[model samples]
Target: MFAVHRSNGLRFLRSGTRTAAFQVRHSSTFAVWNPPKQAPREVPTPLVLCSASHWDSGTRNNIPQIFATMLAEKGHTCIEVDFGLPGDGEMCSSSQDLMDRLSEELKVNLHLSGSPFPPVIFARGFASLIAQAYISSHPAQGLFLISPPPSNTSLFPSILPTPLGEFDYELKFPVAVMACPTEMVQLRKHSRLGQDELVDLIEIDNLEGRDAFLRIEQWLDELGI
Candidate 1:
């Protein structure tokens, strides 16, 4: 899914004897569509829901049947893959490896494994940092960070991991962030910078142990799903 064209001052990374840079021609903005239907309407793209709390992609609790039911009701196709560690029958590896594997599996050129989707939504903060590093190497269309920990140490108390490197968040795309007030404060203070940054932070009250399915539904509705 990548192409190599000679460009000035462009150093191509070599994998084996072939050198290439990853690139995908993003189609014009389009909306998601429900399945078993004929025409594609103006709806958000299919939500590749990532798991949360170190759970595998196929874990029932990670996705919650309710969320699936709601998405089905809305007619949007939800493809939930197991992005967690191995031993669960899903592809098990580091966040970067998993991302590369996922990109190949999904037949997309974008790098998604190292973004906030897997770590914040599935593996917590430290895992998210690993994901961030991967994204830095491979770019993606959007990002979604859900209820990240205050610090990497808070999530992984035994090992203190380093923060992710700098990133450009000015790309023209929609970034949706959902977090509890407390988590939001911590993320704002540590992770997210200005209000006008890459993502539009949506702070929800009473998020402690709250079901995210309903929130996701509401989010889709607001987006005109």
Candidate 2:
């Protein structure tokens, strides 16, 4: 059963499978119940940055902090989740667990915080798969890949046991891939991703020894994000 009060001084009532309408009139001073207005939706905070390090390196190597600092300077919140290792044993299991948590956190925070802001995953080397797999299942607003190696490369072959051909599944959002000139050449030959799949393809002159964080910042500016 349901009842609705109409503005024309009428009350509509529905009982079981029957509907009835009645008019309720009173003096001009008679008070009437009014539905409360819904609160406005809140704007979400800045992106939650997920930073992953190389396969063999530890998170304490300062790489995550460096990137976080760079983003922080631009008024973005960056969170680092360290997968720690690349092998198929403890590190792999731990990384998979972290991915699950990230998905859960994004869901919970978005609802409880009353914000729709989505996160962006930034990964390098072997930990890139952790980001990719998480995004594949949970989906994010954006993805940023830096110097990602081929799925079968020596550095992190086991990181993505699946062949590149199998990654034909469409992603839910935009991706930005930044690779060194050398790495870009290799990626074009072996990677399943193409320019069309990415929002932008950035080529860096030197990635092995140089800091190309500024390029990422510039790209973000271009996006007006």
Candidate 3:
């Protein structure tokens, strides 16, 4: 159960280093965890794409799940894309056709609903490739990559498949890469996300920990978006 509390007509929910104030309502069964103070600061919608094999099945304490729970606790909904493994047990062929189709799927399905504030995209696994394909060209408030595969690597075998080269995208927004120690090494050796301006490379011991989420919140504060 949530450790929810109310005081002086304001409902307080704890998330990371900040507390979000939800509107006090007695009759509603469900209350949105939107922060009242963030209204003026523009809290962008949390857009997440967790690459995995049926992660939302209520079985694992994965990073995406943890992040989603934190969002739920704070009265924010996580808009996520479910990209699971192929049923046939075979990766798709690396081809331009596949990239175009997935790109279209991402564009059509994901909507910018935060109104005047753009979304901060959070992508992991092969979904990171899809997000990269779009965000490299389009605009966003920020991009948070969680344990992404080496850039230009054939993660799904269709979009920019094969280890083409080091990542060389000229991103227009801030970026944060949260990786485990091993992932940190791989990413440092193969990606340019850490070296770029306004990009942060964070090493996390446990992705499901409050500390990791807190670091991200601090990064968001730095972004001021």
**Best model number under lDDT:** 3
lDDT of 1 by residue, 81-140 (tens): 323233235543443454344334333311222223321121223334433434444444
Q: Candidate 1: misplaced stretches above 4 Å?
A: 1-44, 52-65, 86-142, 150-170, 193-198, 206-215, 221-225
Per-model TM-score, in order, reads 0.50, 0.57, 0.65
Error of 3 at 7 (Å): 41
**Worst ten-residue run, lDDT, model 1?**
24-33
Candidate lDDT (C-alpha), each: 0.41, 0.49, 0.57
All candidates: CA RMSD (Å): 13.4, 19.2, 9.4
Deviating ranges (above 4 Å) for candidate 2: 1-54, 58-61, 85-116, 152-166, 194-199, 208-211
- Candidate 2 RMSD to the real structure: 19.2
lDDT by residue (tens digit), candidate 3, 63-168: 6545755664554445444443332444556534344455445554454223344567777765666677667566677888887776655343453443344345
Model 2 over residues 107-147: C-alpha lDDT tens digits? 44334323355666666655455567666766566777776
**Of candidates 3 and 2, the better by TM-score:** 3
Residue-pair clash count for candidate 2: 0
Higher-lDDT candidate among 1 and 2? 2
Q: lDDT score of model 3? A: 0.57
Candidate closest to the true structure, highest TM-score: 3
